[model samples]
Target chain A: MAKLTMTVNGRTLSADAEGRTLLSDFLRGGLGLTGTHVGCDTSQCGACVVHVDGQAVKSCSMLAHEAAGSTITTIEGMANADGSLSTLQQAFQDHHGLQCGFCTPGMVMSAAALLAENPKPTEAEVRHHLEGNICRCTGYHNIVKAVLAASGQDVSGVGIAAE
Target chain B: MYAFDFVKPGTLAEASEALSHDGALPLAGGQTLIAAMKQRLNAPEKLVSLTGIPELKGVCAGDGGVTIGAATTHAAVAAQAAAYYPALAALAGQIGDPAVRNRGTIGGSLANNDPAACYPSAVLASGATIVTNTREIAADDFFQGMFTTALHDGEIITSVKFPVPQKAAYAKFQQPASRFALTGVFVAKFADGVRVAVTGASESGVFRWTEAEAALTANFSAAALDGLSVPADGMIGDLHGTPEYRAHLVKVMTKRAVVAAG
Candidate 1:
């Protein structure tokens, strides 16, 4: 066991964990931050994506012990200081991008990472970047629309616009 | 995953010392290792993480090529090696996905030597040098078979020195589900000759297509491969694809790679 220290969602925190504990388990099971979901724990389904040191990574694919001393941000951190949804989260609502909504956390995290690197990604680029994330509800086109809308692009020409 | 002792060493010596112990596995990226552990398929007594060692991460361009540190993630290679070797960098860019690329390392990919991996094709086709703590091994001598390599248990790859080709490109037919190479081809055209390496198709792991090399060396064009085809018996036949299907992809991807290289 180890006492690992990391800054999560702007708060410096410590968690007692074993070497076998995954970052997802550390967040959900240990820290009780259940926003970081784990759909397919094998890393295929990107439901557990989170920002590690400002770069997105699959939480399940990493060990909490490996992430010690780094800064992290889960879905719980994607809100404004006033506790309202961020632009990306709002876009997901406007576009009706989610069906069951299980994949929303990872999709939001991945979109944030993409915009951080390529702020003005094309529609095709948005779809390509979201390939890691799987939403079985066929909520893809709307999700792509949401990502583009979140980037402040004129997304009216793509996907179903809000009524 | 089973309970295990995890140690992230700050130096290569410490990592090597930790790995020398019984049932001690050196974890580079933990992208593949961690997933395997979740299924209880891999239960190591201890894991010595090599990523924290500064000496094992970065891309240094020299000798008319690029040397990528073992612990350097695919994301780093895609960003750093772009100016030096665009073809290799492009290959690194499309591997897995945004999250997986951020965690998976070149050294871990080459060391694991998965039959469907992308790095082995690039390394074998570029004729890169796999540098470890003890010695440097040629790419030809490094990869043994699927999930096998020439490295000793305690040995860890420090970096890979790739001799950048004048014209080189990789074309992968991705397994839609995993995004891994279903049967990828990497073609490199040097001043003297051409080298072709195929991955994801062969059951014996990555192997060079000498016939394709000879033909492409004579004429560095896609037309030169018009009549080439590999035997299906040696290809991997899984639920994703049949042996015959993989064999066909090898030829098709090779041609596409040659054209892309041109």
Candidate 2:
């Protein structure tokens, strides 16, 4: 067993788990942050995406021990300190970016991270960036719109405006 | 996942020593190994985590070449290689998603040597050197076969040395599901010679397409490969594509890569 202490969703938490414990498992099982879902056991699916040390990563493919001392932000932690939806989350909701919603949390987290880095991304940029996050429903058109909208742009008028 | 003892070693020597033990696996980025372990495909008795080894992470440029630490994430490579090795930068950028690229390491990818992986082709085409704890292996001899490498048990890859090429490019047809190369080709022109490496096709893992290389060497033009044919023998056949389709893709991607390289 290994002892892991990390700041998740702005909370400093620690736990002891088997060496094989995945970061996704640690979040859901240990910290009760079930917002990070596991769609596929393989790392191919981005449903388990989260931010570690401010970089987005697939939590399912990461070991909890590997994440020790890191700062992680899950979908549940993306909201404001007062518990309000982030711009991306609101855009996703406004644009109908999700259906069935299994992949929403991961998608939202990834989009949030992308916007954090490149606030104004083109439609192609948004599509390219979100390639890792697969959605079985809502064929990505709305997701792109959501990301564009979240960037505070008018999507309809200017061919998925950037910035 | 099967229960295992995990040891986060702080040095390469310590990690190597731990790997010398029975059923010890060196954990770099854990993007590949950890996922395999979760599926019960791998159950090492001991995992020597290399994350604590500060030395095994970063990109260093010197002596007309760049040395990338084994634990350096793909994102780092993508974001930084643009100024050093543009082809490598583009290839790294095209790997999986932002998350996988952020955590997956070059050492982990090469060590795993998945047939459909993208890095092998780039490494081979660039004629990079694989630096392990024991010795340095040339790219030509490092990849043995599918899911196989020249790494001996307990051998840890410390870093890779890539001589920046005059011009290079990687063109790949990615598997939509996994984002791995369905068929990928990397072409590079070095001071020594032009090297062409193809991945995601051969059953023997990554291998040089000598004919294509010869053609490109003679004339580095897309039209130079107008009638070239990549043999279908000893190629992989899976649901994503057939051997013939892969053979066709090899030529197509190689031509595209050569064009991009020019």
Q: What is the DockQ of each candidate?
A: 0.88, 0.80
Task: Put down candidate 2 lDDT per residue, B47-84, tens digits, no spaces.
Answer: 99887888999888899998999988899999877888
Model 1 reaches what TM-score against the true structure? 0.98
RMSD of each: 1.1, 2.2
Tens digits of per-residue lDDT, candidate 1, A59-98, equal: 9999999899999999999999999999999999988889
Q: Which ten residues in a row have the lowest lDDT in candidate 2 chain B?
A: B187-196
Q: What is candidate 1's lDDT per residue for B1-262, written digit by digit as tens? A: 8999999999999998999899999998988888888889999999999889999999999879999999999999999999999999999998999999999999999989999999999999999999999999999999899999999998999999999999999999999989899999999999999999999999999999999999999999999999888999978999999999998899999999999997
The CAPRI quality class of candidate 1 comes to high
Instruction: Score every model by TM-score.
Output: 0.98, 0.96
Question: Clashes in model 1: which pairs?
Answer: none
* Top TM-score hit: 1
Q: What lDDT tens digits, residue by residue, belong to model 2 across residues A1-163?
A: 6677999988899988888888999999988989999998687768999999999988988888888888999999888777888888888888888889999988998898899899999888998888888899888888889989899988877443332
For candidate 2, what is the TM-score? 0.96
